[model samples]
Target chain A: MKYVLIILALLTVLTVGFVGLRGQTSRQPPVMVFNDLVDQPKYKNQGESAFFADGRQMRLPPAGAVAWGRTPDKPDPGNLIDDADYYGLKVIPLPVDAALLQRGQRVFNTYCAVCHGGFGTGNGVATNYGMSAPANYHTDRLRQVTDGYLYQVITEGKGLMGAYGPSIKPPDRWAAVAYVRALQRAGNAKIDDVPQNLRGELEKQP
Target chain B: MHDRRLVTEGIRVSRIFPKNSRQIAAALGLGVVLFGGLITAGVTYYFTPKYTRVGYTPYQPVPYSHRIHAGQLGLDCTYCHTNVFESPHANLPSPNVCMNCHDPAKGNIKGDSPLLAPIRDAFKTGRPVDWVKVHKVPDFAYFNHQIHVNRGVSCVSCHGRVDQMVEVRHEQPLSMSWCLDCHRNPEPNLRPNELVTKLDWDSAKDWKVSPLTQNTDSQEAFARKMVKVSALHPPTNCTTCHR
Candidate 1:
């Protein structure tokens, strides 16, 4: 009995020595004991497929496919929409409130801050790497441009800029325009613009 | 007790057997019992999904570091995962997204590094890079990223502090019981929807130091209010996930 106990103890130590403790980082895939229908042979989104010629589960949309729902069609072939002035809207269609501006700021920081700078002063992080001529929102030319024109620029690439329409939806684009206007106003703020209650706080700032 | 023939007038029926056969049989029986119990306990301790799936770290074609991009550079999570809010799956970014910064143009960084060769090749060839999927669910399970994110479940709660990990290992067990642990009491994990992507937002640090004080009014208090506001009752039905 003593010998049997000693043999069992040595065997246990040997097994543990070969395989490290649980949760130790390993490159091997997990062992799924009794994989009962856990991994079926059905196609998954963005999964590999053996049946398809391209070996991709996701199929690209057929050529010239017209969208049925309220989806935006393909961007104009060469930077020219049908109604330039009409689509280049001067007014924001949505209600301009604090909530709208909050969302606009969130969207702007996520999508545009890398290239356009957080303060919209043409000094974004991308500019340090070689991004040339990110438009400064504080400039007179940008301040005077209509909201629709800004929307169009965001949807279509100007010069070396890329189109962000596919990523940012339409309402978000309008909100971003509103945020750009707010940034411009903030950059050119004067003492008179401060509210009477907050004037003391503004004066305290260096 | 065994040698009755030596004690009285009795015949020795099995002289070929060993004198200490009983003790030998008893020792063998006890050994079998001990080994049986050890095997049962070992299997129960080390052979489960929690043990097998916890630390599965796989190698990828591109050695992209979340520590650098998401942590040091402070890029928002949604910059690459654009469709997380809209789709069930948190889709991977295409190679074109990588070119936005590394395109060897006037001010791009590391345009010609051999490490980024696969990304450039995929971008030029219009082919997808074979990025290994980490954190996968069973085929029968239906996990939605949008509902969880939109309801203010931070990614850090499920995937530990990914920004700190050089290569993200399977931080959580992601077992069925683990899911129930949160579903039963989700207040601890809840935060503001706007700060869902803020992986490093520490409540105690923010409550004491942050100026804005967005949801700094005690984490439990905020989570309780959010539960009331969002009607946060995650179902515990097996069909909820198994479907």
Candidate 2:
């Protein structure tokens, strides 16, 4: 009986020791539990800062700071327009190429495809998810709009459409404009648009 | 007291206790202690939030049914989560996005249902709906959705079958070790970029059709080869997640 009790006591000690070895709860570490950096003395954005003379966290730019690279003062080459046509530009200022169209397609797929289907038919899958039907690019009205106008609509957003300017860079937006034009042209492709060798096969699709 | 028997005795002490009752009582006590310890550990292990969070469905402002939209109708995950590929954060659809189909003016579908009151209110008021977050990591950990997505990790890898969920719930224990298990060996989970949004996609089935794996002997070998070709290297260093 004594030996049994002795064994029980030893087992209890072992179990307790094993449990103790586990230390504190593993969920929350204790190393930096009460670190001062979490509650450090700091100024919030645009808040008052005692260290600064103006007492504002936001500092004004230096007096002679002209914005660098394609400065607003550089006279936009008269491509940009400001009128009732939704401030739509009259001409595309950037150079266009196959790479730019490819980039535009990628950007359009990533951003616009949810509303403007992959084929730009305005029948994107989002229409089933309780969204309004987006405008189709194949329409004659949209086709006549200048490239600048398309860029402006993409930049500022049109009607119920939200602006893509914040997410899409300006160059990519231009690329998208170029791609939209391509889609519009593709929608109304003439027999001449097809290659001479492929025209035979195209006409054979009775 | 007289029941004490020395261990050095030549004869095997078959009966140490004075009565069977005492032996039975001792056994019962030991059994209780062992079972008690086991029960305590078992309850602690199973009842902790980490383990229990799997089915924790929280109440949301709207009763949106992912099962109806995603399962029955088969809308892609990216239809609403528009910026999942380009941005670190998955962008929630704006009220205008909902208005695309549910516009009261259009009267297309479900325009008058009271269940869609909040959506209509948000659209009319230009206010955002407050959708509660289901899966959350510790504040210290940094997660970028775009990087994981671009690397061919499917949305279902961590979220489970969200299409079938009426209301989304926590599916996986977002623990450090749970992440390490995948980061250490990501080959099995890797899929083609096009199939990332396809929740029920099977890499094995794809092997037979894929041009890359047509000449390969088996699906397993092809998957491993594709993993090597993609150059997927999910880092495990602390700075990868912490800093």
Candidate 3:
């Protein structure tokens, strides 16, 4: 019994010693450090910084700032009106590109059509949900506005309309503006003024 | 013979009584101690951080060095990963976008480190240059790069020193608390409206440019300015972070 007691006591002491050592060695605090580059410096010239970063500075390339890669002599379809101020607000011009127009159409269908109706008649799903009726693109007020003014309304957003600038890319926004103009023209086109190629098709209608 | 018998009797008594009890008790006690010790050790190991492998480290494609681009070149994170301020994605620039400059610059280089090779291959094959994502949170965690970037959170806040890193590694734990710390209290680095568009300012010369230069009194004026220019948005509500 005495021998058993002595053995048990020795085991207890060894176990306690092991645990004590483990406790002494196990704890560590996580290390956190801040970067100085982001902290101290402000970048001055974007183009210079681009070059310094081993990237090229595109200054007066063959194509202008708006022209992605179209030929200069071809009267690049991407160049639209350059009037900046329209309706007392600074306006961004829409690029005259088919692809951009298509992209803009897609974005409009996804985000705007739900609120402004697919044809921009102001009767969207949100209309029943307390949103005011959006202005119809076919209206004389919108048709009279320049393409620049339309671009501004789309970029900066008019009253009761949120800015689509953040939601859509600059190019895509321009495309949407083009599509809006297209919609307006389609709505206002006279039956007799239909294109010769399409007059036969329209005349065939009952 | 009697002495021998007595000696035998003494030996039996010593061996049978105290010694046997001691041996049996010692075995039982040792068994209990060992079993108890194992249980304790197992419990401790189970609760310890060392045993858990929640830390994820995934392998990437292309070995694109952020250190060379961001650190050495001093390129802004927003340049390539454009739309970080206005959109949800800190989008990887398209291969064509990369080729825009690289194609013209390195026309002479032929072999590896030819700067334009990856871009050329992408253009020729029509396959996108697949970049491995480093800082991926779970799908359930809806994190917007725009809100954080616009609201004064530096790229290094979550991405760590990406410019300095040769290989981009996930540095932050990227837990909810990590996001909330900044969301709850935004920094003063919130950029002004004009500065937002004019991203390539020469920092050396324009170091003293402050967002709050115009002095307009009244809370309404301040509010209007904030709405028009400041990047300060609301907190991370359920819809803000989750949706």
User: Per-residue lDDT for A113-145 in model 3, tens only?
Assistant: 655777877776555544556777778888877
Give Cα distance to truth, residue A198, candidate 2, Å.
Answer: 5.2
TM-score of chain B of each: 0.86, 0.78, 0.58
Docking quality tier of model 2: incorrect
Candidate 2 residue B208 C-alpha distance from true site, Å: 4.3
Per-residue alpha-carbon lDDT of candidate 1 for residues A1-206, written as tens digits (9 for 90 to 100): 88999999998998788776788898988877667787788888788777876557888766665444322564343223333533557887779889889989988998788888999987887777667778888888988988888888877756656666666777787788889889989999999997888898779889
Tens-digit lDDT track of model 2 for A82-156: 222334566666788998998787678766776788889998766766567788988888988888788777766
Candidates 1 and 2 compared: the better one by TM-score is 1
> For candidate 2, lDDT tens digit of each residue in B1-243?
334455434235445544476778978788677667766875565544355445557777788888886776666676578668887777667666565456677524687888888888877774456566666555556788898888878898888888888888667766688889889988777766666777766676766776754566665664577668777778999999886
Instruction: State the DockQ of every prediction.
Output: 0.54, 0.10, 0.02
Worst 10 residues of 3 chain A by lDDT: A23-32
Off by over 4 Å in 2: A1-118, A122-134, A156-172, A196-203, B1-18, B21-37, B40-50, B68-76, B100-113, B120-128, B207-231
User: Per-residue lDDT for B173 in model 1?
Assistant: 80
Error of 3 at B134 (Å): 0.5
User: Which candidate leads the pack in lDDT?
Assistant: 1
Judging by lDDT, tell me the better candidate of 1 and 2: 1
Docking class of 3: incorrect
Which candidate's TM-score is highest?
A: 1
